[model samples]
Target: MVLYGLKNCDTCRKALKLLPEAQFQDVRADGVPGDVLKSAYEVFGAQLLNTRSTTWRGLSDAERALDPLDLLAAHPTVMKRPLVDHDGQLYLGWNSDVQAALLG
Candidate 1:
């Protein structure tokens, strides 16, 4: 399983702290592999992109319209933080609901 995000990302840090045993791959540092990137897009589709993040908001309108797959493939930062992959399933972000689901 892989958790994708920047090591310093607050949500990522919190999620990691919550699941200390879980393996993580900081996308900013490790960089997602082609197969992983493709899997993320296939699993989560546009939801993988964090359109609400400051990173996404900072992008120009033109940059925003580029296909999410392309953006994710080209610049990993465009993808949402705290992506979790477990048992071949992918999830985006770490929210209360996600934590509850994981805990359940």
Candidate 2:
């Protein structure tokens, strides 16, 4: 399992603690690969974008209007935390449902 998120993010840190075997990928430093982002977008659609994030708040209206892929490519932090790739399946966030699906 590979988890994609910012190393400093509390949520990511918690997720790492929960799943010690999961490999952590710092999206800020390594960036999300094109294929991974494409697949994530396909699976999650607009849910992939964290519109409530400070990064999203900082973006201009024009930037907000841009394509989701382009927005994500330019600002990885705008993504919701703890995107997990487990057994070729993509899961977003560490919510109860995700926990049940991944941990249970």
Best by TM-score: 2
Model 1, residue 97: what's the lDDT?
Answer: 80
Report the number of backbone clashes for model 2: 0
The list of candidate 2 runs beyond 4 A from truth reads: none
lDDT of 1 by residue, 1-104 (tens): 67888987999998888877779897877777778778878877778887777778888888888887777766688788888877777777888888886656
Alpha-carbon error at 62 in model 1, in Å? 3.6
Give Cα-based local distance difference scores for all models. Answer: 0.80, 0.93
TM-score of 1: 0.82
Model 1 score (lDDT): 0.80
